[model samples]
Target: SDRKFKEILSKSIHDGHKIYEWLDTDEKLKLTRQLAHSVKLIYYLKLQQQLWQDYYDLGIKDGVWAPRISK
Candidate 1:
């Protein structure tokens, strides 16, 4: 999955238009959701990493951002 994700992202960066030929409608729908979820996850992960670094720099031990869970 990681390999596939990297391939898609690399293709988009290098040859954005060519992805149309590689993906069908259904595949596009599924892949869009997959990519969106992955991107959001990576974004928050990076944000968290930066936050941790900032906290470390400030000598703040317990500062963190926690997402809320819903039932």
Candidate 2:
């Protein structure tokens, strides 16, 4: 399932379109939800990467993972 999701994401990223080819309407909705979830995670990781870099630059070794203040 993870590999399949990665494949879809890679194709979508390269092609600049939704990854819903060959799927029925219901299946397309489900795939859309899955893709949205994956996108959220990717956004989160990118934000975290930026935060880590900022912290490292400031020499901050420890900090709490506060969701409300993340963005």
Candidate 3:
């Protein structure tokens, strides 16, 4: 829904490569590590959401003492 995302993607692919021409090797490594960390964080967040979804779907704890879950 946001055009900013498209612009950022386009700019990164088309014009972002220019930065590497003068960037230091250490800086590049750091940037790549940051990207990898970001990906791993997103993966864990998705897994956490899925785990909650699985718990809700199972409904095995629907006893009188169990907390009620609303739609």
Output the number of the TM-score-best candidate: 3
lDDT of 2 by residue, 19-69 (tens): 435343666657766878898999999999999878775664354443345
Better of 2 and 3 by TM-score: 3
> For candidate 1, which ten residues in a row score worst on lDDT?
59-68
Report each candidate's C-alpha RMSD, comma-separated, in the order given: 10.0, 10.6, 9.6
Residue pairs in candidate 1 whose N, alpha carbon or C atoms collide under 3 angstroms: none
lDDT of 3 by residue, 13-63 (tens): 657545445343666646755775798899999999999877876665554
The superposed Cα distance between candidate 1 and the true structure at residue 22, in angstroms, equals 12
Least accurate stretch of 10 residues (summed lDDT) in model 2?
Answer: 60-69
The residue ranges of model 2 lying beyond 4 angstroms of the native Cα positions read: 1-24, 60-71
Scored by CA lDDT, what does every candidate get?
0.68, 0.65, 0.62
lDDT, model 3, position 42? 100
